[model samples]
Target chain A: MDIDMSLVDWSRAQFALTAMYHWIFVPLTLGMTFMIAIMETIYVRTGKEEWKRITKFWGKLFGINFAIGVATGIILEFEFGTNWSNYSWFVGDIFGAPLAIEGIMAFFMESTFIAIMFFGWNKVSKKFHLTSTWLVAIGANLSALWILVANAWMQSPVGTVFNPDMARNEMVNFWEVLFSPVAINKFLHTISNGYVVSAIFIIGVSAWFLLKKRNIVFAKKSILVAATFGLVTSIFLALTGDGSAYEVAQKQPMKLAAMEGLYDGKTEAGLVVVGALTPGKEAGDDKDAYIFKIEVPKMLSWLGYRSGDAFVPGVNDLVYGNEEQGLISAEEKIERGKVAVQTLTEYKTAKDEGDMETLAQLSPLFDRETSEGQEFYENYFRYFGYGYLNAPGDIIPNVPMVFYSFHIMVGLGFFFILFFFLVLWFTVKNKIDSKKWLLRLSLLTMPLAFIASQAGWIVAEVGRQPWVIQDLMPTVAAVTRLDASAVQLTFVLFAIIFTTLLVAEISIMVKAIKTGPKENEGGK
Target chain B: MNRRNIFARVLFFYVDGFRNLSGWGKKLWIIILLKGIVIFVLMKLLFFPNVLNQNYDTDAERSNHVLETLTKSK
Candidate 1:
């Protein structure tokens, strides 16, 4: 079959573009909802008009961001059907469940409480209003949790079985899929990053007020809350990020190798601190990929494998296979994947011809308790996506892109931690207002935070290229067989629509921020 | 009788609410609408073809092809 590479590329671009746009608003909503809740909680506890003003002020911004987030988010969910109809049918049974649950359980919860939190200020009791705000925060994070669980399943397809009759993966054990270590770690890490984004936003906006010498008391109090929250979550982000890397090393060694720009397998690989890539470096080029490199000694192995001298397979090792590193070649995996595919086809043909005996024989291949089943799935079925590839080099992701994005994200992450620490310290020392340089720096952090967040996503999504669901289906096979032009056209359309909405959102938010918090307008 | 009274009358009755917008505002609003229509309505109607529905007449056909792709050795 002739695969439409253009269709696959456009479909991927469309999805990635929508996902990125959706994320810009989502992280803010996720982080700021809780910040607003915390502020409202203080308002309830202290009964201070000042605290109430801060809560109301941030609450207004949250509402603006949330409205646009909802709009962008709905498009992403629908794109699974519109842009990737094949992916929808292929993994819909298992994938759709979590998404549906997110909608029914989490989205509704968030939207409902948000209404009450915003509009019920004067209507509800103080304690009740605070409860509603907290509920909204919980609801938003719970939404993230379910969606990330779905995404992690794609990254590490667990507790699911391929049914040839349905031509799809079906969940046998919901618990395993929901509670997979990948899902849990991703949820924690992603939401923590959201917290960081929110803290940065709060600090940046407050810094603007400080620079202008307007709303000094309000800005100082906000800085105190945001700084503390940012510091705590930034630490969690680091820890969870470590867990995420470990999971990637275990499940997707190719992705890890690409991220580090590692070409040769090593016993104890140093994690790259910074590196410059040689131009026009191909995956199989004899020359070194990195022109000049700086790395932390033995850190990659220690971080990825919890050992100082663990064997880590590089891109070349994965492509060529390294017996010493216990790495199998992509060629071998592809061969096995073909066999798995052939067997399934034969199984289907037999079933079509009413061959019950053949069905009985094929049944053991899927049976978890059987040794033969375990060997077949663990060896061959696990690398089923390789069956669709034409060359072993197709297994290599864009190394330079992944490597740079990873470094940028990590660098910004550490920078944020230090920034938050300084801000918090200054706030405690009563020198926050006087530190004009720090205030200006904080104001600059908002865009930097956004860039870091986008880069992190690019690493995760682009680093796992060619596979919509890792090792199960290549993106070529997963896309809807549409006219490429049709997809390209719609891609442009969505881009325009989303951009326009984003501009409107920004304009309204800036106007609101410029109008300082009202005094004595408690609840009303 | 007054300018404010006349402005309110036009705002309440006009289709584009031109009285509510300045001269530049009217032009910008029209451009935004035109762009929105071209993108959301015209492009979707013309270019958003249903490839899946066209290629496979039935779910069984699509499923069979997918299964074959997975199982057929390259």
Candidate 2:
């Protein structure tokens, strides 16, 4: 049972590469569908041909994103079976449900109605066509729901039972998995980010049109719609984001600790407003964690636990154990986890050897249905991933990476809220054209939104370091045993393919926007 | 199939719609088609395989192997 460290690294790199590229298209699809649907709704209500033109114009762009998103998304799904087959087998019973539902239900609904939205304009009645458009929006967001639910389950790992005979977690209650607070918050926060991204994208392109003075009426209308949408969703994004962070504190304190670069426990933790980390800082080290910093007093405690004085354990506290805080050291957890592993192995060996008496004795330890078994599971099996760790330091994820990413994401979240408000104000006052600097500044939010979105994911995924399924499994063990070279080759292959596709997409998008929306038939 | 049939009419509607796509629509669609073929058909067939399903034909084998994975020492 020798582990290939290189294989794990390469496999992780490949999956991360595919996911980041796939995401570039997904958020747009998630939010743009709704925006387009709104425009089409307006068209039906007012019999305004211009609104229909706007819908069609955005729909074309949506079609472009939707296609590529499907392509990358398919690769990402298959990577589960390819790179993480073991993890798949472990949680696929639970994870597969949402994913399968996404494909069978949401995806089919989207694909079926998408054609009508595109080509059935004349064939279908206006109301039916509008319904199809709205359905596409709903379908796209629904797809995000199931995928995020699967992701949330990994972060929280609830509502599942360990089947001793099968040696994998199985879903015992679908409702717990679906409506878990973590899942709901993640889904809402993620889709709201999408809405903001779409709003920013539309506003940015529309601003460009205004700057060029090419599509005066079209651009102003677009900005009005997008700015209003952006402002509302940005507020919702912040609320859901708060809930997401609270869940992180409750479920993954280590991640929360890393995100804040906190190395010691604090009863009333101040959230870092901005900070520069001292390089080479590690858990339990005397090195100053931050070289310079600013923080809001007690904000972390309030955000994490909904109280000003709730104790928040940091990296050192979590690793070395905080006795006063009732935190167990990783060293102790590792010992218990090792016992869990060893006993399970002995049970399997005993069963294999037809030793029925030994099996009878060990069976109760693995059974959650019984009281003693529940105790074993809670006290030992819960830390099973720690059994594979070489040292307590292995429990600490890359702190600087998590700390910086979290800061950047929060900074931009506030900025976008302000930016959207100003954009909408300028639009309402009919001063958008006169504010050259503001229009230029508005263009920058699109790229900023992308960075903020990517940073949020970095905090979520990278902060959860070492574990693929929280405490249940470490990523090193979850990765498939494969030749490192094979994974390396595919990584390069995907990089090339995705880059080429992105370049082409940008070029096409630019060309379409420059061409402007199709004029009304015969100029109305 | 009769031209008057609903299915035939629906099929013709899409066929005609796609065939008459404007130049930009047609180009975006071409990229989609090329990407779909490469990602779904070529990439999946060549680069990726379901290791668990490919190697083990039965659930018993999979369960045993996974059980061994969980308990085995590095």
Candidate 3:
């Protein structure tokens, strides 16, 4: 079959660009919603007039972020049919389940409660409104949870069966898919990251207000709430980041290798803290084509396997080498690789020919040969595919947009940990106002928080290149055969509409923030 | 009761019950919708024995047996 790599690349690029744009507001929506809920809860508990001021102040920002998020998110769903028709068809059986649930369950719940929470402020009692706010927060996070489950299924594919006849994967056991180790870890890690992003967002905005001396009471209270949440979420991010890296090490060694820029497996893999990764003949040569690199201690192994001695596959090993480097016979490795290639080839052929019998027989063969018992063989085969399909060894996750975005996100995360702690310390000493520089810095950090959140999403989505569902279907092969002109038209239309909405949202938010809370507004 | 008084009483009960019961009702509604759509789609698409026979071949017979068991259990 003939393949148009350019079309696939173009479609992927479009999707990645769209998704990155959409995600800029998502984390803020997730984090700010919860923070606003907390403020409202405080208002409910203590009947604090100041707390109510804080809630109303932040809730305005939350509403802006939520509106933008909703507007951007709808484009992504439409693109499934418009851009990725084939992918939608291939994994529609499994993928559609979670998405349908997301729309029917989470989206409706969130949108419904959000309206009640936003508009019912004067009409409803404080307790009822507060409950609605909490539900909105839950609905947003729950939306993330189910989507992650579906995504993690694509990543690890648990509780699913390969229907050789159907030419697709099917959910055989829903529980297994839901409880897959990778999904659970990813769920925690992703939600915690959202928390971090949101907390940083609040802190940044609150800091801005403090610096401006516009709404001192609201700013101080908001920053205090944000800092407390930020500090706790930072801790969770660090821990779950570790867990996620460990899972990646176990499941997707290639991704871990790409992230760390590890070229070869070594006894003590140096963690690249920050450095340029230049493409050249020699590793140490400083040339014009310098790539980013940063080196830390034996943190890679420690993070990957919880032990320094653990061997994590470097990019070079996975991409260039076939042998396991110990105990595995070269002949056996070659034989196993041949069998896998044969199985995959036959499976595809059988699928194409609509020969269910041959397809079914080939499915278990690949599965058995790829499981734990066949690690040595499986590793070599995978390495071979990695080399053949994605060569140059070092050019993986080649999307500069994804790579830099991931780095920026991680960098911002570290920045917030320090920033929040500093704010917390100053607030404790009652010298927050005096530390005007810190306040200014916090204000400046708001856009960075949004950028980081957006970047994190870019990395997650773009890093899983080629596959809409890993190993099952290539993303390019999954796209609908629509004329590029049609997509271009829709893209232009969406861009205009989205831009208008964003401008309006920002204007409204700016006005609300400038207004401050009304004195007799009572508890928010 | 007078018309106004009766109307007020009904409104009070509706609002009171709605505030208290809305949360649980929302959750239940979500669960029902998720299950209903999935079951309906699955039945429409795959429940037909002829479609299964055409699609799965030898596996179709086994799947049919399983489907029978599933329906019996229900």
Best by lDDT: 2
The global Cα lDDT (0 to 1) of model 1 is: 0.83
A69 Cα displacement, candidate 1 (Å): 1.7
lDDT of 2 by residue, A307-329 (tens): 99999999988899988889999
Best by TM-score: 2
Global lDDT scores for all candidate models = 0.83, 0.88, 0.64
lDDT of 2: 0.88
For candidate 2, the TM-score of chain A alone relative to the native chain A:
0.98
List the candidate 1 regions with Cα displacement exceeding 4 Å.
Answer: A355-360, B1-62, B68-74
* Per-residue error (Å), model 1, residue B44: 8.7
Candidate 3: docking tier: incorrect
**Interface RMSD (one decimal) of model 3:** 15.1
Stretches of candidate 2 off by over 4 Å are A521-524, B1-4
Could you give candidate 1's per-residue lDDT for residues A1-524 as a string of tens digits? Answer: 25778888898899889889888998998899889989888888998888999998898788667655564665665567667776777895677888888888765775457656755666568898899899989888998888999999988999988776778888999999999998999899899999999999999999999999999999999999999999999999999999999999998888899889988878778998988888788766798878998999999998889998998888889898988767788889889877777777778998889999999998788665699888889988888778788888988888888999999999999999999999999999999999999999998899999999999898888988768899988887677666899788878877887797789778878977898677665535
- iRMSD of all candidate structures: 6.4, 2.0, 15.1
lDDT of 3 at A413: 76
Pairs that clash in candidate 1: A341-B71
- Of the native A-B interface contacts, what share survives in model 2? 0.70
* Residue A63 lDDT in candidate 1: 69
Weakest lDDT window of 10 consecutive positions for candidate 2 chain A: A515-524
